[model samples]
Target: MRPKEFVYHRARDLDHALALLAEHGEEARPISGGQSLVPMMNLRLARPDHLVDVNDLGLDEIREEAGALHVGAMVRHERYLTDPLIRRHLPALLEAVHWIGHPTIRRNGTLGGSLCHADPTAELPAMAVLHGARIVLASTAGRREVAACDFFKGAYMTDVQPGEMLVSVIFPCPQGAHSGAFEELGERLGDFAMGSFGVVLEHEGGVIRRAATVCGGAKMTPIRLPEIEAALQGQTLAGLDAAALGDRVTGLIAPAGDFQVSAEYRRALIGELAGRALQRARDIALNAQP
Candidate 1:
């Protein structure tokens, strides 16, 4: 079915977009790539009375700011594959981007749209949580930054209020030598994942100094494993037990069953993916050592 009749307003600038949003309030929906929203609208899942087009608002640049990478909300997924800043600082995101839909989806899907859409199985949200990124939301009132972990309230929900638009995301640069890996299992190449895992390891002298892990497609939102990260601290790469860590993850997460798979199957799949991601991350860190 086609979307309900709505007024379309093409925003000329950032302020214009905010004003449009403020004027329409909850009745307005700001659209950029429209990869996620348009489908929802087509299915009548969303029926905003006004559509505020933000594609021309100039929120599509990627740059390094202070000690973090500042990625404009409208930056497309395709950029993640080629941007030097993303390559250097957020390689895991680059890796995960490869798993997103297909070439067409990657070419048009915007980072902000994906995060705001907040699919529990999406790779971008899981990457944001793994990187400890900050999401910037803007409105006529002002702007506020929310932690990535807290920004996602649930599937298809976020902290973004009715009158606000996501401006950009800020990811802190890794301080030392680091490596990351992303792994997932899906029914098909571009299908939504059955389970996915991402791991980032900051290491020195073959020992883990810092670690961050996140899982997707297994919970309400991307789940960050702080306890697992803490357990990895000071662990030497030579003695790390991937299977044991996988077992620990299996015990910690309780994934709900669905039509595609049973809860126990998903739990085991996530655990295996976590172990593979961790092992791959460790190997990459070791290879980078001088």
Candidate 2:
């Protein structure tokens, strides 16, 4: 099915886009790469009365700011995969970006688009939460920063106000002894993960000092394992048993099952992936100290 009739407005800059959004309110939808929104429109899942084209907004650059990486909203998945800055400062992003869709999809799927799309299991949002990333939202009024973990309200929903657009994502440069890893269980290379996990580990004196762990695909939002992270604090990586962590998470999270996967099975996969991600993070924390 084709999308309903809509007025098209080509925005030339950030101010133009914000003005268009403000003028149209919830009736307006922004389009960048159109990977997610176009399909939704085709299926009649979304029928905004106005299409605010934002490709010319110049929100596609990757740069550093105040010692952190400021990734523009229009930065495509392939851009992050290829950009030396992203590869160097946010390795977890690199690890997860390659798993999103395929080359063609990555070539066009925007980072801001993905975050705003708010898919439960999408790589960027899950990894962002794992790395304690912040999302910046902009509108005609002003802008505000939100924690990645708090950005999502539920599946395909976010804190993005009606007239606001996601301008950029800010990732703190990893400091001290830290490492992160992402892993997921999927039926095939490009399929949605049955279960996914991302982890950041900080070590001191051969003991875990801080941990950020998040799971995806199995819930409406990425589930950060703070209780488990608290449990693992100060634990030596070598002494850390995967089964123990797996069992602990399995008991804490109750993910609802979809048609493709059962809740029981999803829980099992989440438990297993949790261990795998933690182990990889531990290895990096132990050896890749910078």
Candidate 3:
């Protein structure tokens, strides 16, 4: 089905976008890459009366700021996958971007758009949760920053209000002792992951100094396994019993039955993915440090 009408607004800048959003309110929907939104519109899932086109707003700018990396709202997936700054600062994000759809989809998908769309099975949001990323939102009322953990409220839902637009995403730069890894199980190379996990670790004195585990595709929002992090803290990678850790992680997530996999199967794989990702993160952390 085609949309009943298409009212397009091209914003000269982010402030202009905010003005449009405020003026149109719920009738407006921000358009970045249109990779996801267009498909939904064609299926009648979304029927916004106005499209706030941000492609020309220069929201595609990407740079490193102080001790954080700021990626603008329109930064494309292909750009992200090849960005050296992102590779050095947020390797997990780079890896995650490569897993989002295929080359054609990646060329059209935007980082901010993917996060804002809030698909539970998507890669970037899950990795962002593990990295403790922050999202910058704007409206005519001004701007505010929110933690990735609190930003995603439910499936395809976020804390963003009707008149607000996501400006960018900021990720804290990783230190020398820190490293991260992402892994997922999918039926096809570019399909939504059946279960995916992101792990970030900080090592000191041959022990785990800090860790974060973000799991996706098994729940409404990315599941950050703080319990797994707490359980593994201060433990040396060499001394870890992988099997035991897997069993423990299995009990931590509450995955439900979906067409992709049974609840029980997803629950079992969560343990398996968590253990593997943690091990890889530890290895990467150790190799990078010394």
Candidate 4:
């Protein structure tokens, strides 16, 4: 199905995009890579009367600002996944990007687009939740920063206002040396996962100081399992009890029955995925030590 008639604006830059959004209000939609939005439009799932295209804007740069990494909203998944700086600095993100989609989709999918779309099964949003990433949203009013923990309100929902656009994503640099790993299980290779887990761990003087357990496809939004997180901190990764850990996570994420996987099945897989993800992170961390 073709979308209804709409106006299109090719924004010259950030200011142009902002102006277009402000003028059109909720009737306007921003199109970056068009990977996600195009499909939705084709199905009539989204029927925006105006499209503010930022493809002309030079917002694809990825650079280090102060102590953290700043990725422009237009940056493509392929560029991020292969960037040397991203691999060295935000290893967890690199791990997560691989699970996004196949190479073709990655080439056209922008980071900002994914976060704004907010699919519960998406890997990037789950990564943001795990690492405490910050989102910079802009509008004609001013700019506002929303932490990942508070940005996602529900499945396919976010705190972005009608006239605001997600400008960039900020990832705080690691305070101490850390290792990151991600593991996911899907019905098919490259398909959305039944359950995906991302782990980021920091070790100081050989003792685990902090760890994050970000789970996806288990709820309405990607969630950082606090119950599981509380148990893992300071506990040596090798000493993790799979059975016990499984039970704890099961209670935390009693997945509601969905068409993809049964609640019991999703609950069961979370434990397995969490255990393996933590173990991989530990191995990566241990190997990095001198």
On lDDT, the leading prediction is 1
How high a TM-score does candidate 1 get?
0.98
- Candidate 3 TM-score to native: 0.95
lDDT of each: 0.92, 0.86, 0.84, 0.85
Task: Judging by TM-score against the true structure, name the best candidate.
Answer: 1
In model 4, where do residues sit more than 4 Å from their true spots?
237-243
lDDT assessment of candidate 3: 0.84
Q: For each predicted model, how many residue pairs clash, with residues at least 3 apart or on different chains? A: 0, 0, 0, 0
Write down the RMSD of all candidates, one decimal each: 0.8, 1.6, 1.4, 1.5
Which model, 2 or 3, shows the larger lDDT?
2
lDDT of 1 by residue, 1-290 (tens): 99999999999999999999999999999999999999999999989999999999888889998989999999999988988889998878889999998899999999999999998899999999989999999999999999999999998999999899999999887768889899988899888888999988888889999999999976989999988999998999878888889889999999998889899999999999999988888888888888
**lDDT, candidate 4, 129-225, per-residue tens:** 8888999999999999999989999988999998899999898866688888888888887787888888888877666788777888778899998
Model 4 accuracy (lDDT, Cα): 0.85
Instruction: Give per-model TM-scores.
Output: 0.98, 0.95, 0.95, 0.95
RMSD of 2: 1.6
Candidate with the larger lDDT of 1 and 4: 1
Stretches > 4 Å off in candidate 2: none
How would the candidate models be sorted by lDDT, starting from the highest? 1, 2, 4, 3
Estimate, for each residue in 141-196, the C-alpha lDDT of model 3 and write its tens digit: 99999999999999889988999998899988876567778888889999978888
